[model samples]
Target chain A: MSLSESTSRRRKKRANGVEFTAKEFKRQWILIAIAAVYVIYGIIFYYLPLAGWIMAFQNYKYKTGITGSKFVGLAKFQFLFSDAKFLQVIRNTFCMGALNLIFSTVMAIVFAILLNEIKNIWGKKIVQTISYLPHFLSWIVVCGLVHDALSSTGIINELLVKFGIIDSPFQFFASKPWFWPLVVLTNLWKETGWNAIIYLAAITSIDPALYESASIDGAGRFQKMWYVTLPSIRPTIMILLLMNIGNVLNAGFELQYILGNGVIQSVSRTIDIYVLDWAINGRNMDFSLGTAAGIFKTLVALILIVAGNTIAKKTGDERLF
Target chain B: MSINTMKPKKKKMATEDLIFTIFNTTIMVLFTIVTLYPILNTLAISFNEGSDAVRGGIHLLPRVFSLKSYKTVIKTEGIITGAKITVLRTVIGTLSSLIANALLSFILSRKRFLFKSGLSLFWIITMYANGGLIPTMVLFRSLNLIGTFWVYVIPGMVSAFNVMVMRTYMAGIPDSLEESAQLEGAGYMTVFLKIISPLCKPVYATIALFVAVYHWNSWFDAMLYNRTNTKYTTLQYELQKLLASVTAQGQGGGGGAASQTDATVATVIPITIRSAATILTMAPIIALYPFLQRYFVTGLTIGGVKE
Candidate 1:
């Protein structure tokens, strides 16, 4: 059939309630072709890795590869659990991640609220702009700046010594106890402003009439902020909080890897660094063990996400999925 | 007496509001200073005489003004090569990913596309679950992409998040426009290239900036897959190595026989060079940020609201 005739026939078929027709197929052929390319790309880069997860169950050797490796039945996972260093790494990850989450979230919200209260448009714009500047910087650059500012001879230590906060300049990087807080601070410095942007948007969407009503009810500035603004953006806050919960284990590796030294390694090592230390850099590279640790991390993240979503659903709030 | 008291109370409330505004503005100004001081300090250190920078009190301005560090950094072979590679990858990576993602989004946004749900589901599943780092590394190695430049470009050619954002943007473009073009016998490619591409400029710019910045900042992948190859090192990775070397030298001064020499060397020039390298690394992004900031904000709002 000619194209036009077939299309007309398809229209007749549609009138008879046929959902799809050959004419529609022909028309969508180009789109289908384009989508196929994405499907192939997705399969290779994404789905292929999922299939590669099977290596976690095997004694994965480089020479033998995943397909040729022997099925080990969770021996690698057992090894990860038995390792004391790994446990320490997990503890460090949780501590750093939790601190980061709490600090960044609270700071972002507070910053957003404070920013929204600014009556001067120029001041608000300038502050918001400057705040997000750090977010654009690479962690490599941020860590370099951090090291410069916190080094023994750096301004921060110099100021502390001059102010008599300390008798002498201290090596911030060398102190194990300072690692978690430093990580949190660095994360806050880089991310708080960027994160605040979302909250700021959320605040903007709030009804002006609500604020007007609050004012008519004789609410003060603080009272309106507390009762009207906060409650209005609460759903946004809850959704973001739930999403962050799912990332509790992803403390990240770059900052710790860059800033960590021999003296502070105990506090600085995260799950990612631990895996890299064993799987890629150790005396005997254990691929299966590393894969198993990764698998464990992914499973925990999945559980956290599902649990978070469940909680959000139960609370009648926004759910990520 | 009650009416007179109400007037005073209203005046008091106005003063209270004024105080709050002033208080809020002060905090913001302080916050801005805190955010800006570090960058300015880094810049100052970079411009300071190498020897003078080590004395360590250069707060807001260069103490002994000199361009020695910048000259040295610019002349360094490692940094120049690393920068060239970084720029090359960022351009290629961003362009390829943007095109690929745009295509996927266009396909998915079409109401008549049969496999939209399945395609979206395939990408979404990957977002939440992954095979983890080791397997991905092994896969890359097996594919012989470890030392190749394609490793950077190919693996990130399509970001699901960008695809979704673009899809959302595309969905907003009136379907009647495309229908009219189709009625005139314009093919899908013509419709996309002529109609949709021009219309989706805002989202395109947003995604492009994001992909470009990501490529520019990425170091971990270069550190991992390109470990054996110095030629593949990016600017961030090179700077990381330079910083590590400086720290290593500083730490070694504590116990090594060459402690005195190392200390002198550290005090002489390493800090300034490190600062200069850092400033150089951040210069491009910081320069371009103001112009690109609005698009990012718009993108964020669109993505956040849709979700």
Candidate 2:
């Protein structure tokens, strides 16, 4: 009789799928609720503010809220597309990104392979420590160091003249062609050591037997490296390559911001800097275009990430899913 | 096979290894000179008397060393205020980020968290699609966080890669530990904090270092949000402005120690003061790295191991 009566009063799953009788469901919901607050932390601070993308379509003003800002639809993009300066910014961004990717990866991989070959552990540790220090430096210090070395009377120029490489001191930063290489090399110097950290991990994971077999087959160090080491770390290389492709649009902001000058601004301006200049300095207060540029960067980055991941998947079993 | 792993070779003289060591040392010495010289030059300049910095040909050492530039730079009330803000922001920001990352990653690590896939998709979508900076700035202003230090820390608290790293590390942590804790009547929070968190100590340290350093180094947020409010400028921003002002003044051929206040009066500036300001700005991080380097590699690997 009690069971029959209870059957009439039985709990059912809620429409939102919280089973009334299930403690696991209740606990899950409770945890989800607590986590929802943090999800908002990501949303309110990191994600939702992206709604500011609408401003790219509007003529934004400090006086007007985003809702009140005048919508200009495609005008900002049209202007940007037509602007020669913006075009230059695009070219510079891509060129720098491509060069940086090539040089940083190659050098880092080579450095990692070389470091892995070090028979003495202490020497390797010292080299790693020395290399990683530069990455900790803020660009402000880097820029100053850069300025010191590149100045007309700086050590670089002095050395160049003394070595009979040049007749007189050449202004490194002042020259356009030199600026790009300088930026690239400066980045390489700061990042190669730190960047090689992952490759070192990949190399360490390589089975010792493979190297032994290569030696048994009479392979020298170079042959063992090419046949054994590189293949073992191939997946790491692929994944890192794919991940970096997503960052191609980011190019860099700090280096350009610091090294940029009137003479070299044309080739040095990145999309981030361009958007920044317009958003902060220009009178148009036309935030929509700036927002559009941001959106463009995000979109391009996303496409590259997905595309790279797909290509990686097709080529190798591993990809950033 | 065990001996085969060693190629069963004779102990050949390591002459080549010695040569390679010398080569490596030479490479590293050049690297050290390249890396440390400019930084050291800046340090020397920061220490140099403000008067001699403008002649500007300093290399490994300062020709006329003095601590006047440091005194002048450090004496400014703004630097103290900025440093306070930066340290506060770094600490609080790191705490918030660690919390957020841990929570997000924990949820994602659990297979039974029904919305794990949905939430990852949601977060990843946000990574690819965003309104952009101005809109975000507008939102900050509307929220009245524009001039607040929150502007510096909030937007960057939880990054995609950091979250992913945290998730991967959490996933790799043996799940049986959690099951055992549960069997002993430990709740999820207890399991997470008392047990799992400790297991991820190396990663915790690395993330702390990373987020802390990031907050310490960032000037963009301050540049954007506190541009006019020098009262809330971060140390890095203040340092940058000092450099910019010096460079602008140095344009004049007038030989001299330039006064910071009279930034416009002189076209020429001391090289040492600029270098000194740079050194002053970066000293904290330089000092911090050596102590943390022992943990760095292990921490870096845990946090950065690619999926």
Q: Which has the greatest lDDT?
A: 1
Note the clash tally of each candidate. Answer: 0, 15
Per-candidate local distance difference test: 0.82, 0.73
- Worst 10-residue stretch by lDDT in candidate 1 chain A? A1-10
Model 2, C-alpha of A134: deviation from truth (Å): 1.5
| Native-to-model Cα distance after best TM-score fit, residue A242 in candidate 1, in Å | 2.1
Measured by DockQ, the strongest candidate is: 1
- Candidate 2 residue spans exceeding 4 A from truth: A1-22, B1-25, B246-269
Scored against the true structure, residue B160 in model 1 reaches a CA lDDT of: 73
TM-score of chain A of each: 0.92, 0.90
How good is the docking of model 1, as DockQ?
0.46
Q: Please give me the DockQ of candidate 2 compared with the native complex.
A: 0.36
RMSD of each predicted structure:
5.5, 7.4
Off by over 4 Å in 1: A1-18, B249-269
Lowest summed lDDT window (length 10), candidate 2 chain A:
A1-10
Worst 10 residues of 2 chain B by lDDT: B253-262
